[model samples]
Target: MLSKVITIAQQKGGTGKTTLAVHLALAFVKYHNLKVVIIDTDPQGSLGKWFMVRSKKNSLNKNLTFKTASLWGAQYESKTFKKDHDIIIIDTPPKIESDARPSIEAADLVLIPMTPSHVDFWATEAIIEIAKKAQKKVLVQINRANQRSKLINKTHEYINSIKVSATNIIIGNRQIYPSSMGEGKTAVEKQKKSKAVEEIKKLSEQILLELK
Candidate 1:
């Protein structure tokens, strides 16, 4: 079966882009029992670092694998990994430059993770336009969100003002993400009762539907 490519991307840095990628990869591996492959295209190598840490521990899934590559090599890896894995998640760079384009173009779906702020909200236009130009679909995911906050509600209004589609789930601001990632574990394993785990699982449900 051809693997579904989901590229988590954002033009601005620190929008929980890598967090979303890591959580989703873990969820797919632990919950869905799918063989997932992660391609880290970020120059900072954060995703690869996380995978390395996870590698130190006993991996939950023997079939799940991760590797790093430049944007130039991502296209080849995207095509190559699908033959052996059920899904391929590419963590692209934090810009819309050539480094991010290759992964976005190879994506079956590009996830735009943005925090609720004027700068973060507005930055979506560039990446959205880039995805559109690539003739690919874009899905928005609200990251570092708090549902009860006025800013969160206002951000909802902001999203409504835009014409793009987004996931119904909200990834609330929580410490479990960073803490769990540090130990190479996901929210599901580290903070089982926390809302953060629910948010990740909920987002993946919508993502799974979109992939179908």
Candidate 2:
């Protein structure tokens, strides 16, 4: 089987790109039973930091591995990593830059996480363009959505207005996500029965369907 590359990207920061990358990696290993590797292309190294916590806490999954890539390049890095893993999840930087393009280019599917706001939706155009230039499929989602708000419908329309494929699943803004991550735990380990956990499980299913 070919290794699938899923790049979690958004042109703007605070759009929950890293969150998606990390959790999706865990979901693939824990729920989908796939060998997963996370490549952090973001200079911020947020994913790497979490992996450190996992190692320190002994929570690291043997099936999941983490690696970091330089901002200077990635086309070569992506190709090399896929040789060993079932899924190569790339966490790209929060901008459309020389670095992010190669990561998006290397993706089989690029996931754009948008907050439920006009600004977040508007920020997606440039990254989506880069993904299209690379001819990669994209899935847009209202990530960290305010579950109690009515704007979810508007966000859906906005995503569609831009002619991008939108996933029916939306991730909610919940304290549990970060709290669990801080402790080197994922929803699968901490809040197995919580709403946040269910959202991630659904996201994995939607993502699989999109990949098909």
Candidate 3:
């Protein structure tokens, strides 16, 4: 199958972009049984570090591939990966405004993760505009949020006001997400039957529909 590129982007830091990318990559590989390649375009190199840990633990997974590149380089690299992989995920650095276009343009979908805070709301529009200008599909992912917070309502309002699609499943502020990543495993791989695993599974299903 030809690969579909999904670029996880956020203009602000601490939005869990790297974590989301790795989780989604693993979900596609394990649950969907797809060949996945994740490209780390962020200079922070967090994704590469996680992949290294996973490699040592699993002796390098055959279904999952990890690579690094610049934002511009990712556009070219994702195209080449499409020949064999079923999914290509690019994790980008924070605060990359206009420089984010090459990566966004390469994506079949641009996923923007935001917490239910006013600060994250403020930081989201610039990247949304960039994705809009690039004529790419954009999905706002609500991450690390408390389910009962009133802010969740406001977040949906904000997404509607901005006129972008969002996933119906919100990634909760679950400990399993970060703790598993720290051990080079996903919730699906670590706990197997936890809420975090279910959230990722549903989110991955939603993303696959969007890609189709």
In the range 10-55, model 2's lDDT, one tens digit per residue, is 8899788888888888888888888888888888888889899988
lDDT of 2 at 182: 92
- 72-115 per-residue lDDT for model 1 (tens digits): 78888988998878889988887666567788888999899989
TM of each candidate vs. truth: 0.94, 0.94, 0.98
Error at 27, model 3, angstroms: 0.6
Error (Å) of candidate 1 at residue 173 is 0.4
Say which prediction, candidate 1 or candidate 2, comes out ahead on TM-score: 2
* lDDT (Cα, tens digit) per residue for candidate 3, span 54-81: 8889744769989999999999999999
lDDT of each: 0.83, 0.82, 0.92
Worst 10 residues of 3 by lDDT: 53-62
Model 3 RMSD vs true structure:
1.0
Q: What is the lDDT of residue 40 in candidate 3?
A: 96
- Candidate closer to the true structure by lDDT (higher is better), 1 or 2: 1
